[model samples]
Target: MRPTRAKITDAISAIERCFLRNQDGTNSVKDSTDSLSITEMTELLESLRGSIQRAVSVEQTRKPEFDIFLLTFQRWLLTDIARDQALLCDLLLPILNEALPPSASITPQTAPFVEKTLQFVRDTILRCSVAKDLIGKHMIGRLVATAVCVHASTMLKRQALDILNSLLAKSKENKALLTSHTCLTDLDNLVHLLKNAGDVELQTQLVELLFRICPKPKQERLQFIDTLHLPKIFADIRGDYFHQDCRAFLNQLNAGNDGVLKTPKSFRLSHAECVLGDTTSSLTLNPPDGADSLWLDFNTSSLSILVMIAGGDILSIELAFSKVQRWQVESSAGAFLPMTPIRI
Candidate 1:
């Protein structure tokens, strides 16, 4: 016989009881979590995650059981129940995707849940390498989309960017897997999203994201960079003191100032002196101040910066280089000033 609403309610209540916080204040999921064997845990996880996926399909996000389901899966993760196995990764991916689907309407109430859900996943991955790599393989695109989704909540965008930053930093594996033309499109999309955003902190976060996902061997960057043409937008925002870091990031990606230069004024002079018959000798780039220059301290050479013809209102920041088309500049410049810009 088909299950009645009463039976389903009872089943849901029972699962909810397993995950709810205790009045005693200990980790509530601990006792119930301790009771499951690997096989039983796996089966329960599949069931819970599947229920969530089904709820998402029906647009039932308003229901309380939607949260109950996520709580159950999240509680299972809080324990050592499945520790980095592909099975756990596999189960979690669908639940996460359902939580923040690329094409979902995000109302204020639903938005926080999505943002918090992403934060939970990010925190979980931070604790396990196997989980990090596994999720990176399949979730990179979705995460990028989340970070750049124009209509999505800012908290969601920032949180998704944080997770991407960590995964991309872990090693060459994630860098190679994530830095592709497909992924670059999302970066471009984010740039467009923030083109008119007045929120300085959000703009700063996007700059941070750019530093994180910037591809290596910039020759491989065209598929992404070429598609992003925001010269006018960048030019408009460059004058704002709050936008200096964002301008610096674009200057590096577009102008090749990915740090490493010692003195901005002198560097410009030397650069000008080197070029024979340069028409833009008159073209001025207002570089950063001598005491505090805008420099990018990338952690790896595996990370590459795109060759953008940087042209915002800032003089030294703007560059007129030869038409190399898509030249790559890899930076390993350490010992740089700490700078912060906002998001994608």
Candidate 2:
């Protein structure tokens, strides 16, 4: 016999009332929180599952109404304004599998309903350690791939990334799934979007993801570096990697000014020399005392010489050279002259 619209509405209202009562301390539902002490949340979830299954199996011709009920149930699961239990997640699995076909045909009005269902699961995994563990055990890669393929939104994509990241972090047991080529490919594409899509928060989140997923070896770091031009992107964001304290000396040198004198002599140069030149040629101008270094400009010209002067009588001598050549003599200041002196 076909269930009337009024009957279905009443059932939905009853379930909603249970949900609200659970939240508001009424405890009307006979699940774990009430008289059905041994029943557990999982059992309640099973009952919901049986109901959805029976509704769907009644008749193929009645699918639309069944779908409506299923959609409403999903909406409640996602955003009931009450906390859901593990049983809800267990009940959701079969429904998710069954709802795929109908979800594909969902209208704009119904899209949020479907999306909220996915968001709820993701939020549960993120918010509760036990829920995350349950998802890591039961869902993880499978549902994540479904969400990524079915829900085409930047927000959903970000949520999927977050879920994957959390799963990978909490349970290193899923390394094979997390590191699979397909998963990595999706992550790579998402990282590209975050890095280039003008979304600062997304980019920040992606950076954290990268730190979590990227391996701890220098080779892996170099591999990531070679793949993306993060240095260039972060260069303008002063005090990032380029301006770290370890590289503060380099930043000062690039600023074309004598940086702090932690060392007796300092070099000042342009960005090009620091990034492109060899180590020997990229040294600081006025090399520190007892320091044998060359400070060459981008044009490969010596900027200054820091040779020891007797009794601390240091001389600041600027060589004027017109062409690329080497001087073969040492200056009176004990600095090495180029092999072939250039005309100045």
Cα lDDT, all candidates: 0.51, 0.43
- Top candidate, metric TM-score: 1
Give the best candidate by lDDT.
1
**Tens digit of per-residue lDDT, candidate 2, span 47-85:** 455455544441322334445444444434443233555
Q: Model 1: what TM-score?
A: 0.57
Model 1 lDDT at residue 280: 38
| Candidate 1 residue lDDT tens string, 227-272 | 5654433332322453554655444434442333211111111111
**Worst-scoring 10-residue span by lDDT in model 1:** 263-272
How many clashes in each structure? 18, 4
